[model samples]
Target: MSGHVSGYLSIPPLRRDLLIAYLAAAAVTVHVLEAALPGPGPWFKPGLANVFALVAFLRLGWRGAMAVTLMRILAGSLALGTLFTPGFFLSFFGGCGALAMLALLRMIPSSGLGVVGISLLAALAHMAAQIVAAWLLIIGHAGILAALPWFLAGSWISGVLNGLLTYLLLEHFDRHHALLTEP
Candidate 1:
């Protein structure tokens, strides 16, 4: 009985490890694209990898999502040679906030709020974490106010995009493999 229960609690073997690997690769790819594309602003990012993070959270729970997120961050930072830097910390915190929001969304039905709602919540979390990081490490007290506008705009836009993309991808996977439905 205990073994059966443990099995039930264990993550379903649905190629999640492969998916995590793919997501990590995707993150590296996106980071490279961002560097090569030369965006108008420093903060501009597609946040392409966030799609996987949300999916992991929804399907595999917080621990799984955090594992993937941390791995992605570590690999991504290493690839970009930004490890132990402020950028890595910002990304780490942002991912943590987004995952937390995704976990929260699990309590709600997927009908009304759905992915968009989750995205908004995650975006706000991401922004809040960044702001706190800035205050503590970058600029101190005044940094919060200074970071407000950019944080708001960035989080709103990025969150919505990430949410929409994640919804689409998850929907696709659900239809074919029922990835998120597995026990």
Candidate 2:
């Protein structure tokens, strides 16, 4: 429990809304810490915090997923002082793309994809949307095109790892739902 913030794990499950709020707070905390870590650059994060949205997608459906994603981005950006900035827009659009892609994949009968499949597609979508945002809002043109390879590489690697972690986590929760709330 080192570095765990006080009152973070102390949420009372009085209602579903409260639970979602707690989850959003946890995701935002993860986002902030992950952003603080050393990485390829400001634009590159392993995106471990994104698992919250993926989990919401799997357990609560796409609406919950989008809700969690949006809340996480808003709260995280506010915490990191990125609100209303280019970074905020990037986070916002990227999340929207991820949820939309996940929804599309879910609509097709027997895409036969599980967590990893959804995660990969969503990650690519998120990156694409972010890149497009950057091109339109900041980077402007071919200069940003050169960064595509790096972004894609990061997305694939992190997406796979995060997806696997989420799969295992969901499996664990399925077996131990009670344990999750025993703060």
Candidate 3:
């Protein structure tokens, strides 16, 4: 071997990458556990996993949040045996839509929108994307559009609750763990 070594695997992961991996693992765990809980309906999940995504975004940035989301969806789907199923596709598209909205919102400097506001908008985007996915992939008809209002309403409620929880969690971290306050 040469005196020097240069390989991707040989390189140690950055702190940011480690943080991303930690957040993704947390999100995936929440996802799997949440999937087991009985909800009002298949679409009415509290989306507890998204709380971790929000935390990742705030602490690590959009890319970190995206990593957590992908990990949650993919690993959670595998755990739930929903891989390659309609549920997985719905989740993938919905997550993409939510991330897209978050990216757009992040561009607006000091928009006065707090975590709750951002979460609400993102949740709506997620619901809309899922509806469209349902129409295009499964139903193949406009009838799926009829459920938009209900889905949006549920999403709004879940988003608000999740945002409040995230806010509280962040506040606690800020008070008890100053290290988490920094990116």
Candidate 4:
């Protein structure tokens, strides 16, 4: 841990907040930009912004990850003018589900899974949460369940891509930022 900020607890409060702010801003930018792209469907997104959240989790711990996520959702929603809309809740809840999954996975032994595995699982959780949110909050019909497979398929692909991008980013950080690394 020499000279490295390995975990949330290890960082000075001001520095942690500053780091969270920087990560949140990046996540928000990605979230807003991604929303502008035309997707295969209304709900389909590559979730590129999640790479930052994963980076925060790996380098800064759960609190930092959660901070980035919450900020991204709130600020992204506002930026897109989707606040308090069905779309906003979907993103919010989906993000929460992903964070929850990441937290659970974090409790496991580090060797049990790699970044890609965690990303895949988190993506699935995000989709599942969105599906449930749609069913309960909007559709109110069992027919919505029929779309789960397709949504999960999309999640699988996006998760892998995002994870790989995150891996690359982490590698770069490890090469240059001596203070950032897994706890």
Candidate 5:
């Protein structure tokens, strides 16, 4: 027919969709796996899946990261069967906060800070947003926000861990692929 590849596993999705399906699938796997792990508390999650966000931001730019994050949220929720539930809303808003922070932080020169700084800041925003959502929407009390300290601390630790991982991956990709180093 037309001068385009046609098949279930054709190149169109990867070329046009920009590999969002693959990203979403990976995110879903991570989300499901992370849920099964025990954390310090109900408010604490390692957020390993977010490692992809940092990578996407570095490789694909803000728009790509945004798409990946949105798809991750939707697909992750569906996989976990948390869609439309309070958990999903919390995750959605928290992801939005993280992405918003990342978008702003990208404006920085990235001299003193790198993926580590970005990840830590985004993690803080994510935790803060989730806490606020819980307080205002779920708990309906200001006191629930008190746990923010612990959550923020957890976010910092997890963020640094994930950020380092992202940095390593980017370093490797840039070294091998060389696209990121282009000016």
Candidate 6:
């Protein structure tokens, strides 16, 4: 009876503490890379840490994803010396938007859509949050009309690129680490 009870209790194969450590490290590395790399646009970033965020969401649900996102933003801001700056606010709100999009996606039933869909949705949410944040905190207006063309083009291109990279990383992690299969 005890053996059967133990068998029924499925313990997580990976330790939560270790996962958090790895995610934090990955976030730091990605943030540094973003700071160092030069892209065509001003805010173009690979959003490499988002891979961990997506994996956390898929594996451990909203709490896990939110943990990773918050940690990543806080740590990344500290690393870049932008802890109390507008950048941190942007990242925080953007991350919340992304998480909301992922949570919403989890509610829907869709086939042939995988991490790419999550990435795209998250990217769009991130952009929306940034625009809102910009207007409320920086510009004091929508500012959409002034930078309409650039905003559209840049957001589309950068979001697609970030989505593609996230999808590839997710596939790789899914096979190599099995992180996505935890839940």
Best candidate, lDDT: 4
User: Model 6, range 58-135, lDDT digits (tens) per residue?
Assistant: 555666778888898888888889897987897888888888887787677353455566666687787777778877
The stretch of ten residues in a row with the least summed lDDT in candidate 1 is 1-10
What is candidate 4's CA lDDT for residue 101?
A: 94
Evaluated against the true structure, the overall lDDT of model 6 is: 0.67
How many residue pairs collide in each prediction? 0, 0, 0, 0, 0, 0
CA lDDT of each prediction against the hidden true structure: 0.67, 0.76, 0.79, 0.84, 0.74, 0.67
Best by TM-score: 4
- State the weakest 10-residue window (summed lDDT) of model 4: 1-10
RMSD of 2: 7.1
- TM-scores of the models, in the order given: 0.77, 0.83, 0.86, 0.88, 0.82, 0.77
Give lDDT: candidate 5, residue 70: 87
lDDT of 1 by residue, 1-183 (tens): 110101112444556666666666776676656656766565555666766766666555666667777888888888889898998898888777777776676556433565666666788887787777777777778646675777678777877888778777665655554344553
Query: How would you encode candidate 2's per-residue C-alpha lDDT over 9-118 as one tens digit per residue?
Result: 22244544555665677789999998888886644578988887777677656766777889999889888999999989988999988988988976883666767867
Q: For model 5, how does the per-residue alpha-carbon lDDT over 1-183 read when each residue is reduced to its tens digit?
A: 111101122233344254455555676688888987777676568898887766767656677678888888888888788899999999998999999997887676433666787788889999999999999889999998889998898898888888887777665544553232322
Winner by TM-score between candidate 4 and candidate 3:
4
Instruction: Score residue 183 of candidate 4 by CA lDDT.
Output: 26
The 10-residue segment with the lowest total lDDT in model 6: 1-10
> What's model 6's lDDT at 54?
67
* Tens-digit lDDT track of model 4 for 154-173: 99998988888888887675
Candidate 3: where are CA atoms >4 Å away?
A: 1-13, 175-183
Error of 2 at 43 (Å): 7.5
**What RMSD value applies to candidate 5?**
8.8
